[model samples]
Target: MVLDPSRYQDHRTWKMTPGLLRARQPYFRNNMIGLAILAGVTAGIYSYTYRFLHKDNDFADVPIPPIDEKELEQLKKEYEQHKNERQ
Candidate 1:
């Protein structure tokens, strides 16, 4: 819906706080620093949560073994022992 700008706004504005809001708008844009901080915090939280939930699944090719690689090495050692015993 298109709003009539003339009904809500005027060039002559009496601002109580600088950078607080557009002329005639009730919403305030004051404390831009706080808004930025909140946005950054939200984004950081979301990113952290999303990564924690999905990192391993998404990065299937990641070289880091998800489980103990020692199991494989133990199996190999066992096989080698058995082969040596046989020979």
Candidate 2:
């Protein structure tokens, strides 16, 4: 037996439907929290990948202290005496 669409159409009321009632209520549509989370995760992944890619090289920029001339001369003298003693 086939069902008649016209008989059910007359009994269907838009005012009593749960879907229509829920659609009329205000909803929280702001996605700022989700966006911030995504941004943080993306930044963390990018920074880690960049660090891994440059791990083998000395990329850190640090200041060097001045070397003393006396220390250099003393090291040279010690090396010369050791070499002479070995011969």
RMSD of each: 14.1, 16.5
Q: Which prediction has the highest TM-score against the true structure? A: 1
| Separate clash counts for every candidate | 0, 0
Evaluated at residue 80, the lDDT of candidate 2 is 100
For residues 1-87, write the lDDT of model 1, one tens digit per residue. Answer: 364334334436532444334442553445666799999999999999998987666667779856578898998999999999999
Task: Report lDDT per candidate.
Answer: 0.69, 0.70
Off by over 4 Å in 1: 1-8, 11-30, 57-87
Give one digit per residue, the lDDT tens place, for model 2 in 1-87: 354334324344423355544664444244666788899999999999999988866745766778799988998999999999999
Query: Per-residue lDDT for 43 in model 1?
Result: 100
